[model samples]
Target chain A: MKNKAALIFGYNDYALEIAKNIQDEYSHIYIFSLHSEEDILKNKSDFEIKSFDLSDKWDYISENIDLENSIAFSVLEDIAENIFLTISLRSSFETLNIIALSNNKETADKLLMAGANKVIPLVQTTAEMISEMMEKPIVKEVFHKILFESGELKISQVKINSSNSYLGKTLSEIDWKVKYGVIVLALVLEDMNSEFIYSSKIKNHIISEGDIFIIVGYETDIIEFEKIIGSRINVHWSHWSR
Target chain B: MGFFSRLIVNLAYFINTSDAYQRKKRFFYDILENNRYPYKKYFDIFMMTLIFLSVAILIAEVKSEVDENIEFFNTYVISIIFFIEYILRFWISSSVTELIINRSEHAAMLGRKFSLWRAILKIIKVKLNFVFSIRAIIDLLAVLPFFHELRLLRLFVLFRVFKLFRYTTSFQTFVSVLSTKKFEFLILLMFSSIVISVSSVLIYVMEANNPNSPINTMFEAIYWSIVTISTVGYGDITPYTSEGRVVAMFVITAGIAVLAFTTSIVVSALTEKLDEIREIKTIDDIRKLKSFYLICGYENVAQEVAQKLKDSPIGIIVLDEDSKRIENAKKDGLVALNYDPGNMRSYKKIGIDLSTQVKAVLCLRESDVENVYTTLTIRSINKDVNIISLLMDDGNRKKLNFAGVNEILYPKGLVGIISKELIGRPVAFEVIHALRNDYYGVNIEEILVDNRMIENTMYVSELNNSRYRVILLGIYKKNKNRFFFNPLDSTILESGDYLLVIGNSVFIKEFEKYLHKKIRT
Candidate 1:
């Protein structure tokens, strides 16, 4: 069933973000922006988008008038442009849900007066971020990915079970692949990543409760094995596997 | 029970073990372990074999239990125990420590470890530790003066069950091997169990009616079969008939080989898995510290950079993989952990993630490549962080430069530039030595500013007074990456401009006084 959708007009990257988050839920979405074709083409992310200039609404509507399936919401930073786009989309598609971003209280009141279904003010969000950045530079990176420029390897968590032959032994004696074709990156326990990578051949580095191994494998293998790897592996804590 | 009493006993035992006069003491004293020699392992096994043979001989040699040959029996039994303990000890104790320390052929002959006589001496020597331990007293009772008067004590010799611990290393190795080979060895163990069960049934079927048949039932037969296979060969029981004897012989040889094979494999497996001690990698070995530091990654320049930083009392974190460098660091008592700071976790190990505590992080890893990475990770965490790094290869300068490091130390390129001056004189070397040692390490220190200065004041002298007692070395004009090493003295110290000074507590106090004056006004 195709559900009624909203056209996210212009909240910069957040427009695409909203569309992506609810794209599968809603049947359709349309994003309009001033971003150039070159900028859009340069991005490698896999998001489906179709763009058209707001001033050329007549030609856009005449060519592709699919307003029956969607709504229009302008997230443009400028007040005059957002109001013009909202009024234009409403005049043509009266039943469509209209939303727009506002820079201030007066702008939000203006957007609402122009027949927007709702108006979200963006100044408060920027004001909070401004305060944060001014205070802490260290916390900013913590909120982003830590890139190891030269190191090619990445670490992730995996669990152990009887299907793996190295249940009772340590890392030094296990034949990592001969027994199971998984290169243990590191053991991730509750608090820290352990020093040893227990291969199939290690005899003394015994697998214990809550021991998660960081394993590296081919992407396809990892995907196929995720059902067995990531989920809780129910192992009976006993002397031998039943 | 008392502390001094325990100490006294322990010391006395130590002196006994360490004494010069004691012959066969090393083996008997067993100072290396639980006070027993491993040669006793082979001896016990031999004695068990003899016991098995003696039981067989008693049944085979005498058809009647009531015998007129008590003297012959006594001589034979006494000789067996005597030959096993004394002769074997004497025989085994070759090149023994008692002999070596005494530096005489006679003492060495007695002290030779393998000799049964030497073993006897060792046994007596061990009795010394029993002076305090209850277990030791019981052990002495089982072997000695009590045994002479009481035949029960002689029988207590069978309490030699304690000899089992004597082979702990081998046993531990075997257990480890079994544990590692848990999956593979399980199959063989199952097969061995079947074989043992089958042999017991077969013996019970064949020898049910024969007198003197040790196979009284399936259980006894199975037990005997296991004992024989494991080479325990206790002489308490033996097969009577010729048919049973034939089966026993085959089982004995096969059992010996299988047990030996299992033991050897386990020992080899255990030894292989024994040690996997992880050594700290360079740079990661450095522990976290709060601010103001220098790190010289390579050995060549490390000495100079470390010396200079040491003079300033700043926390210096050095990381190098070379053992020689690590050993040298150990002598210095600086916070260090061996690891590649270029690697992801290693950087975190040195607490790059906690860069707030560290005022500036120096990328002094092995080469320019690592330095570039160190700079990148450090900067990615703290965008405004002060970073100074080395570049051995000129080609790597662009990469390190892009990483936002404050300064790059290019050894070869800088040397080429320095060669331009003092061609004949050693003034360059002296300058290099002093700079490396004490020439006020740069690219560090806080920039204090008067927040209340007039917006248009351009010259530094307007802000200069005893209240701002420090000299204005430089100003970090906001939004610019360039630094003036020694700023023009007349340059403006605006409200936003930072006054750089070589820090001292007194100078900093006076400078803060300027800030107090600004607030008062």
Candidate 2:
């Protein structure tokens, strides 16, 4: 496995939060501050802070990190700057994964068009939706366990290869929940269209090589499911997330 | 106390304290005075129809000899209803027994002799006050036609038109506007009366004795003065003398001034009441709603919630003190009101029947303190209304919880968590977001297992996920008050259980239809 690194562009609360959360997941975390010298000095944090301007080249980034194994977050508070940063990173490093934060729908669309792998719209709509869904006590409990209280539950995607035993079997032929203690949420087809596992159109559809199954379970249970199914955990497509 | 007096006091107390008596009085009060009562509209419609029908019959009788049956229906049925309504109004206007009981209780509390005579006089005073009120007088006159023997009382039937004022809210608002401008109207009346009286005397003195003039008497002169002052200009009684013409000129000018003054007064009063009337209409519309979500502020969170719920079956009403925000919300095609969300009276003013009509309340104010206050106000109004508030600051989370907020949403924290998840498990986070946002028509829905399903003895295995095209995430057993996640295939489904499923929304609807169809078969 290649060593993973994170290059977070923009030094703000959201950047700080992402850095802090993913600190242990990656071997190195770098926060690129776009502000002036005084402002960067004022923003003292545990992560390594480096100053960068919008017009700068990626010489320092390329020298310091492996571009192919790194993830870059374009989370500048300014929407225009964030889009520009995403474009610049994508133009500089073709293989680096780029994620951007947006405040509204228009900016989100723009960020995606500007070469971001994924755009997280930091709008209140998602919050309201979560609040509405939390009205159900069951949902609240499940989400609380998954996002806050318990860290054991993991959602992982596994892609079937040619040698997998379940490659030619239909979804209905397997009782994954009873046999493996994991719930398969959806399946990504060869064309990248995702379908719910229980969808009637895909009920009898045979799983084959390159088919990705999105599943959720405890970490141990997921790994066991992956082992028994003869597949490896991987994200097949960058845009397949949504 | 004397024995007779004690008997009277005991009787009054019994009547005042009896549940049956109080209930009957309350029923009448609800029908007559409580506009919020659901049945009041029906009562109002019935009374309006009766009044119109009786008036129509009265007009028909003047043109031709009406059929005896129709005449009897009009004379007896309509008048009897009016009479009963008047009696009910009078009975509910003030409680005589309560006044008596209260007076005697007060005297006893004061350690003084209870004067029966004074109490009787006080009761009469209160009753007389109601009887002499304009509404009561109108009610009395409307029922006067019941005395068929007195032909003169038939003219009083016209007063029934005034009774319509009590039934319609618009008329009540007009009356309120007029009442609010009482001082202005009084001044206008005084000014016009002085002008008319002085002009009438001047014309009478100047033109009554002129032989060639058409005004031959003081009465004619006074009539001319009134015609000129009203600007009617009948031309039948024009002043022929120059002095009389001069007086008429002054009266006409004063008449225009009085007309302008009256118009200004009424216009200003109506303008002042326009907002209140509009609010009343909005409240009436809200009262008619079967279920609605009350968003306490028209901020971003509220705007998003309202937009998302716009296509839903439930109604949405946004309230904020900032008129600009309300206007923006209105432009977004939502029912918005410029009302202070923190004020307890706003709930009452908006007619939020939380126990019945209000499905939930979202306190999404920008200020944490305001959200807490709104939650407290809503909880104070009704304890069972589901309240969700956005926590503007982390420090206010406990405050919001203590204020009885059902759910507290921290948007920044939620964003932080999502950002973190995106870094660690990007695909999973995106999948959840897509499900929540209903991306590509996929979403989560809850379907209730009703009595039909229970009667059919359905099992979890019977609801095949592949067949239904939906994944059963869990079963919320209402009886157990617990959710059974990933239940076994043989788990028997029961009534009141909510099935939480995830799938394409269209497929979910079809699956629900199939469930219903299966039960029917």
Candidate 3:
């Protein structure tokens, strides 16, 4: 069998960005174009480049490409072609994961109907990224980690059980990094409501059973800290240690 | 016909597995499910007209001046039509029995053989299910005009108007929106009852014996109290004694307080519920969605994101504790929830977990600490969902990341980049700004090579030399994760390559047209 690859259809900036982000996850990355084959060939990119028509039959694709192990990106700028490509690919290959890029919700719905497994709206991500970069505050306290701190630190949360010794203790009272080898970030109440320990609403909130504490530490320290507070929540990001 | 052959036809018809049956099912769906077609719309208009005419005749008959026989005849005509419509709805639709029978894994095990008794049993089961359904119950209640001679039974004719709600999309949406806030309305009602009753008893004790008092008994006092609290002041009752006057004054002030509080609560709840209704029309709509970004706290960052997404085709639901913020978001044409974002009940109320389509949850609260808490709570609820959290405090990044936030958006770091980019490269900044702002008609577009062109190899300069009006800015090779900018003309064409092209609006349209023709051919 040919090596598993990510088939990104579209010769565009968004497709390029997507390829950049997910390249590490696949063995081979193939860029397919529908609009301009000459433009693609002129670009001296290190990876393989190819062109294809939206009307290409499944038999033709299956003969040329390994559909079983390939994931496809249908980021063609034309919403109709994107949807058509998604539908054709989906009908042709039942398990090929198809990700399509949509310009808006209506097209996104159409693409979804066309059988794209995932549709990422381009403008929204750009808006989100630009807003993130332009509007954030730059106080030292807020920028301390990104600016001053660097380490292989991991964050996790532990629920405070009724049996824990630090039930009523405040943040100042606990030498968290020394005693528990973890830094308490915030507290989540039993009602599933959460607040930063230093925030006005929770500055003096006495620790109680069922309150989850967001903490940060090394992998071993987090394990040790989990023993004291209660069972550690296997946070989705806890795999960074692995 | 043999029982087996009849059963096969009946099963094929009822199960609607055949193409003809599927078409019939689509017809039923178009008419019965929603007012989407001209036929259904006209049908709704016809039914509404008949309902109003019947209502008018009933009112005229109640006045004792109209001919009772004519009114009775008209009522019968209306009821008969409604009855027919209801039966037609049942016949064309899939009965509950057919659904269960077809869905069951035991269908094959039972073999192709069918019996008369089994068909009867299926009909009986479906009838029971249909009778119990709210739609059928409404239909039955609305068609009770046969008992028009009974005065008490005639009162049920009012329920026929409610059937009109089913035909009107706006009316159904309004009712469902109210039902969503049923608990709040119920609480307000309960509170109003207590206040009126207790105040009535107190006033009855204070003024029942006063010679000048209009209020005499507990019932009269209760009526007076309700009128006072509601600010209706029908002017039928008055307090005479000094104690009674003081009690009345206190009750009046309390009435204002209650009205203000309850009205505010109901108005806000109704607004939020209506927005929710607009978000999801049917379960199928939610099921069809691949995934949506859930934003908690519609603060500045969240608003910015929502504004940008409004023009895009991404599904987003914004949750905020402030009704005003939610109202603002709705004004901006966004699906926003004005409930506690951290509440699991609220999440379920909006159908968040229906399918794993919740792609990411952005905890955009201004507080880094709160963001962390939100990240943790969301993680606990759905471990697989990606969480992108705003880091207000840099110190909270580790905590947020540890709390299972897949991505941490450092707003502060972004500001730093903007300042550097602005000062270091102003010209490049303007180009970036133009693209971001879509200045002029110039835009950057990404085009993917169609599989039909997989065998063809064309160089970049050749395309630039041709009728292609777009400028090929760059090329990205997928396997190597390489982006070749301002590429050489000798680059070989391959399948699945991405070309970043730039062109004006007209040229882009031309290029797209050219591409469509090329790909289709």
Give the winner by lDDT: 1 or 2: 2
Candidate 2 per-residue lDDT, tens place, B1-521, comes to 88887888999989988999999999999999998798999999999988888788778877699899987877778888888998898888898888888889999999988888989999889889999999998988898888756877766667887899989988988898789999989888888888878888888888878898888777786787778877778899888889988888898898788778888999999999987787778777887889988888887667777877777788988889999999899899888889898888877767777899888888878689889988888888889988888886677789999999987777656656776676655556556666666776777778889987666647898886557678887788888987676778888899999888888888889988777767524
lDDT scores of the candidates, listed in order = 0.50, 0.78, 0.65
Candidate scoring better on DockQ of 1 and 3: 3
Better of 2 and 3 by DockQ: 2
What TM-score does model 2 achieve against the real structure? 0.81
Steric collisions counted per model: 50, 0, 42
Better of 1 and 2 by TM-score: 2
True contacts kept of 2: 0.21
Interface RMSD of each: 26.5, 2.9, 20.8
DockQ of 3: 0.03
Task: Compare the candidates by TM-score and give the number of the best one.
Answer: 2
lDDT string, candidate 3, B34-132, tens digits: 553658887788888888877787787765776767775666878898888788677755554455455332444665444445656676777778778
Instruction: Write model 3 residue lDDT over A16-122, tens digit each, in one string.
Output: 55565556566678788775568566756665677788775555357656665566778776777788888888887876767677756688788877777555554
- Tell me each candidate's TM-score: 0.29, 0.81, 0.40
User: What is the alpha-carbon lDDT of model 1 when measured against the actual structure?
Assistant: 0.50
Scored by lDDT, the top model is 2
